[model samples]
Target: FKDATVWTSEEEGILVHTDVLIKNGKIAKIGKNLWAAGATIVNATGKHLTAGIIDEHTHIAALSINESGQNSSAEVKMEDVVDPEHIGIYRNLAGGVTSAQLLHGSANPIGGQSAILKLKWGANADELIYKNSPKFIKFALGENVKQSNWNSYSRFPQTRMGVEQTFINYFQRAKEYDLKKKNGEEYRHDEELETLAEIINGERFISCHSYVQSEINMLMKVAEKFDFKINTFTHILEGYKVADKMAAHGVGASTFSDWWAYKYEVNDAIPYNAAIMQSQGITVAINSDDAEMSRRLNQEAAKTVKYGGMTELEAWKMVTINPAKLLHIDERVGSIKEGKDADLVLWSANPLSVYAKAEKTLIDGAVYFDLEKDKQQREAIKKEKALLINLMLQEKDKGSPTQEPKKKDQEQLHCDSL
Candidate 1:
C-alpha cells in the first residue's frame, strides 16, 4: 500500500504519508517511498490504512452454535461445524474485519471450544482457520445457564447458586480425573473431563459469557478454588461494577460497545463500562456477538471515544491489539508492523467516521474483498435472483405447485435462549 495515511495501532500510533510493503503474506516493511523489485504495487494515495479489525466474539461460519442436549459440552467444537460459504464472512471482510473468534452458543454452563478464523472468504473451512491459535473454551454464567428463560426446570443448576455449585462439582471431578491420569492409574477417557483438566493445567483458556456482578465474582472465586484463571469475560456488560476485582483476577474483558438493558441482568450496564475496566488496569476489548455488528467493529470502537473520552488511537486498539492480546494472537495479526501478517484494510477515510468504507481488504496479502469487484458481484447476484424469480412465476402460470419463499434466518440465540 503506497502513500497512505496509516493507523499503525502500535506504540508509535499513526503515521502520515507512509508506504507498506507486503511480501509472502507478511508486512515486510513500513516507511516512506518503500519499493520492492517485481512487487505488485497498490497505489493507495490519500487513503487510510490500518491493521484489519478483529471481532473478539461472534458466532459466524458455524452451522450449529450449540449442542444443547447436555449442560457440559466441551467435547463439541466450533470448527467441526464451520460453514465456509456463510455470507457473513464476505460481509465482515467488506467492513474491514479480517479475523474473528467464532464462539459457541451460551446455551449451557460449559459450551464448546471456539474457533479463531481469518476472513479468508471463498476458502475451504480448514484454510480459514488461524493455524496454531491458542485454545479457548466457552463458559456461560448467570441466567442462560440457570434456565431462567425456560418454561421447564428439568436441567441441573436451575438457580444462580446452583450454577456456582455446578462449576465446583465439574472442576472437582476433572481434578480427580487429572490426578488419576497423572498417577498412571487406570481411568476411562472422557472428553468432557479431558477438556476441564486442560483448564486446570492451564492448557486452555476460558472466554465466559457473563453478566451481573455477583455471578462474575462467584465464577472468579470458583476459578481460584480450582487453581485456574478466567482468560476473558465476554458480554461482561456490567463489568464496571467489578472492574477492580476483574483486574485483580487478571482477566481481560471482551464486551459490547454500549449495549445494556436487553435483559434483567444487564439493567445496570453502562456505556462507560469498557473505559472503566481499562482505567482499573484490566485489558478491555469491544466485541460484537451479533453477526451484523461484527462487520462494522470500527464504529463500535468509535463509541468508546464518545462515552469514555478515550483517544481515537486508544479506541482503535480496543478492537485491534487489545483483542489480539486477549486471544494470544498479538504476534500474528494485530498491527501494521514489520513481521506481522499482511491482513489489512484500505479505507476511504478515517475508520472512526461512520461514512468511512473499506475499499480493499486483504488477508495474508490476498485481496479478499474489493469494493469495485463487489459492485460487479452485486449486479450479477441481482440478475441471478431475477431469473430465478421469473422461472418461479412461469411455473405458477402453468399451475404447478409453488411454495412461499424461504426467509433468511436471522434468529440470534443468546445465553438466555431456551
Candidate 2:
C-alpha cells in the first residue's frame, strides 16, 4: 500500500503519506515513499490504512451457537460446526474484519468451547481456523443460563444463585478429577471434566456472557477460589458498576457501545461502559454480538468517543489492538508494524467516521475483499444464474423428472438468540 494515512494501532501514532510493504504474508516495512520489486502496488493515495478490525465476540461462521442439552456443555467445540462458506465470512471481509472469536451462545451456565477464525473466504474448516489455536471456552450468567426465556420450570439452575453453584460444583469436580489424574490413578476419560480441568489448570481461558454486577463479582470470586482469572466478559453491559474490581482481578471487558433496555437485567447498561472500564486500567474492547452489527464495528467504536470522550486512537484500539489483546493474538495481528501479519484494511476516510467504508481488506497479505473485484463477482454471478435458470427451463420443457422444491433455512444466530 503506497502513500496512505496509516494508523499503526501503536504508540507510533498516525503516519501521513506513508508507504507499507508486505512480504511473505507479514508486514515488511513502514516508511515514507517505499517501493517493492515485482510487487502488485496498491494506490492508497487519499485512503486511510489501519489494522483489520478484530471482533472479540461474534457468531458468524458457526452452524450451532449453543449446546444446551445440559447445564454445562464444555465438551462441545464450535470449530466442529464452523461453516466456512457462510456469506457472513465474505460480508465480514467486506466490512474490514479480518479475524473473530466465534464464541458459543449464552444458553447454559457453561457453554461450549469457542473457535478462533481468520475470516479466510473459500477456505475449508481446518484452514479457516488458526494452527495451534489457543483454547477458549464460553461461560454464561444472568437470564439465559437460568432458563428465563426457555420457561423450563424443572431446570436445575432456575435462579441467579443456582448459577453460582453450577460453576462451583463443576470446578470442584474438575479439581478432584485433575488430582486423581495427576496421581496416575487409572480412570475413565471424561471430556466435560477434562475441559473444566483445563480451565482450573489455566490451560484454557473463559469468555463469559454477563450483565449484572453481582453475577460478575460472583464468578470472579469463584475463579479466585480456583486460582484462575476470567479472560474476558463479553456483553458485560453493567461492567461500569464494578470496573475497579474487574481491573484489580485482571479481567478484560468486551462490551457493546450503547446497547441497553433490550433485556431486564441490562437496564443499567450505559454507553460509557467501555470508557469507564478503560479509565480504570481494564483492557476494554467493543464487540458485536449480532451479525449486522459486526459489519460496522467502526461505528460502534466511534460511539465511545461521542459518549465518554475517548480519543480517536483509543476508540480505534477498542476494535483493534484491545480485541487482539483480549484474544491473546496481538503478537501476530492487530497492528501495522514490522514483523507482524499483514492484516490490514484500506478505508475511504477516517476509520472512526460513520461514512468511512472499507475499499480493500487484506488478510495475510492476500486481498480478500476489494470494491472492484466484488463488483466483478456480482456481475459474474448474475450471468451464471441466468444461464442456469435458462437450462432449468429447457429441462422443464423436455418433461425431465424433478422433485418438489424445498426452501433452505439460513438462521442467523447470536450469543443469546437461541
Candidate 3:
C-alpha cells in the first residue's frame, strides 16, 4: 500500500503520505518511496490505512455456543464447532475486522473454552484458527448464569453467592486433582478439572462474562484466592464502580461501547465505563457480543470519543492493540509494526468517521475483501436468485408439485440470552 494516510496504531500517531511494503505475509517496511522488486504495488493515495480491527468478544463461526445443561462445561471448545461457510465471517472482513475471539455463551458459571480466529473467509475451520494462540476459557457471573430470566429452575448456582462458591469449589477440586497428578497417584482424568488445573498453573487465561460491580469484584476475589488473575472482564457494564479494584487486580476490561437497560442487571450501565476504567490504569477494549455489531466495530470504537472524551488514537486502540493484548496476540497482528502480520484495512476515509468504508481488507497480505469485488459478487447473487426464481415459476406453470420453503430459525445467542 503506497501513499496512504496511515494510522500505525503505534506509540507515534498517524503518518501522512506514507508507503507500506508487505513481504511474505508480514509488513516488511513503512517509509516513503518504499520499493520491492517483482512486487505488485497498491495505490492507496487519498485513502486511509490502519491495522485491521480485532473484536475481543464474538460468537460468529460457532455451530453451537453453549452447553447450558451443566453447571461447568470446560470440556467443550468453540474450535470443535467452527463453521467456515458462515456468511458472518465474510461480512466481518468487509467491515475491517480481521480477528475475533469466538467465545462460548454465558449459560454456565464456568463456560467452555474459546477459539481465537482470523477472518480468512475461504479457509477451512482448522485453517481459520490463529495458530499457537494462548488458551482462554469463558467464565460468567451474575444473572445469566444464575437463570434470573429463565423459567426453568433446575440448574445449580441460582444466586450470586452460589456463583462465588461454585468457582471456589471447582478450583479446590482442580487443585487437589493437580496435586494427585503431580505426586504420581493413580486417579481418574477429568477434562473439566484438567482445564481448570491449567488455569491454576497459569497455563490458561479467563475472559469472563460479567456486568454488575458486585459480581465482578467477587470473581476477582475468587481468582485471587486461587492464586490466578482474571484475564479480562467482558460485558463489564458496571465496571466504573469498581475500576480501582479491577485495576489493582491487574485485570483487563473488554466492554460494550455503550449498552444498557436491556436487562435488570444492566440498569446501572453507563457509556463512560471504558474511559473510567482507562483512567484507573486498566487496559480497556471495546467488544461486540452481537454478530451485527461485530462487523462495525470501528464505528463502535468511535463512540468512546463522544461518550468519554477519548482521543482518536485511544479509541482506535481499544479495538486494535488493546484487544490484541487481552487475547495475547498483540505481537502478531495488533499494530502496523515492521515485523507484524499484514492484517490491515484500506479505508475510504478516516476509520473513526461514520462516512468511512473499508475499501479493502487484507489478512496475511492477501485481499480478502475489495469494494469492487463485493459489488460484483452482489450483482452475481442477484442474477442467480432471479434465475432460480424463473426456473421455479416454469415448474409451477407445468403443474409440478412444489413444497413451501422451510424456514430455519437462527438462534439469537448473546451473553445474556442464555
Candidate 4:
C-alpha cells in the first residue's frame, strides 16, 4: 500500500503520508517515497491503515460450543470441530478482523481446548488454523459451571466452592498421572488426564471464563497450587476489582467495553474495566464474545477512550497488539513492523470512529474482503435471485409440480445444547 496514514500500533504511533511495502507475504519496508517496480500501488492519500483486528474471545467457526457429557471436557479440542464455511468468517473479514481465538463455551468447570485461527475465508478447516499456535484451554467458574441457570441438580460442583474442589481433584489426578508417566510405570492412557497434565507441565495455557472477584482469586490460587499460570480471563466483567491481583499473577484481561448487569454475577461490572486494568500494569484487550459484535471491534476499542480516558493510539492497541499478546501471536501479526505477516486493514477513515469502513482487509498480503467486490457481489446476487424467481414462475405457467421452499436450518450450538 502507498501513501497512507499508518496507525503502526507501535511506539511511533500514527505516521502520515507513509508508504508500506509488503513482499512475499511479509512487511518488507516502511518509509516515505518508496517504490518497487511492478508492485501494485494503492493510492491511500486520505485513508488509514492499521494492523488487522484480533478478537481474543469468539466462537464463530466452531460447529459445537460445549461437551456436557462430563464436567471436565479437557479431552475435547476446539480444532476438531472447526466450521470453515461459516458466514461469520467472511463477515469478520469485512469488519477488518484477520485473526481470532475460537474458544469453548463456559458450561463445564474444565471446558474444551481453544483453536487459534486466522480468518482465511473459503479455506478448509486445517488451513484456517494458525500454524504452530500455542495451546490454550477454556476453564470456567461461577454460575454456568455450577448450573445456577439450570433446574437440574445432577451435575456435580453445583456450588462455587465445588468448582474449586473440581479443579483440585482433577489437578491432583493429573499430577499423579504425570508422576507415573515420568517414573515409566505402566498405566492406561487417559485423554482427559493427559490434557490436564499438559497444563501442569506448563505446556498449555488457561483462559478462564469468570465473573466476580472471589472466583477469580480462587482460580488464581488454585493455579498457584498446581504451579502454572492462568494465561487470560475472558468475559471478565468484574476484573477491575482484582486488577492488581491479576497483574501480580501475570494474567492478561480480555474484557468487554460495556457489557454488564445482564447476569447476577456481573452486577458490579464497570465500563472502565479495560482502562483500570491497563492502568495497573495489566495487559488489557477488548474482546467480542458475540458474533455480531466481533466485526466492529475497532469501535469497541474506541469506547475505552470514552469510558476510561485512554488515548486513541492506546485504545487501538486494545484490539490489535494486546489481544495478539494474549493469544501469543504478537510476534507474527499484531503490528505494522518489518518482517511481520502483512495482515492489514485499509480504512475509509480513522478506524476508531464508527464512520470508518474497511475498504480492504488483507491477510498474508492477499486481499480477502474488498468493498468494491462486495458491492459487485451484492448486485450479482440480486440479478441471480430475479432470474431464479422468473424461472420458477415459468415452471408454474407450464403446470409443473412445485414444492414449497424450505429454509435451511441454521446451526448455533451454545453451552446448553448438550
Using TM-score as the measure, which candidate wins?
Answer: 4
Work out the TM-score per prediction. 0.95, 0.95, 0.97, 0.98
Candidate 2 vs. true structure, TM-score:
0.95
The candidate 4 region of ten consecutive residues with least summed lDDT is: 409-418
Give the alpha carbon lDDT tens digit for every residue of 38-80 in model 4.
8999999999999999999898988999887678999999999
How does candidate 4 fare on TM-score?
0.98
Arrange candidates by TM-score, descending: 4, 3, 2, 1
Error of 3 at 144 (Å): 0.9
How well does candidate 2 score on lDDT at residue 155?
71
- Runs in model 3 lying further than 4 Å from the true structure: 406-409, 416-418
Task: For model 2, state the Cα shift of residue 380 in Å.
Answer: 2.5
Q: Over the stretch 146-245, how does candidate 3's per-residue lDDT look in tens digits?
A: 8887866897888899999999999999999999999999999899999999999999999999988889989999999989999999999999999999
**lDDT values for all models:** 0.91, 0.93, 0.93, 0.93
Query: Whose lDDT is higher: candidate 1's or candidate 3's?
Result: 3
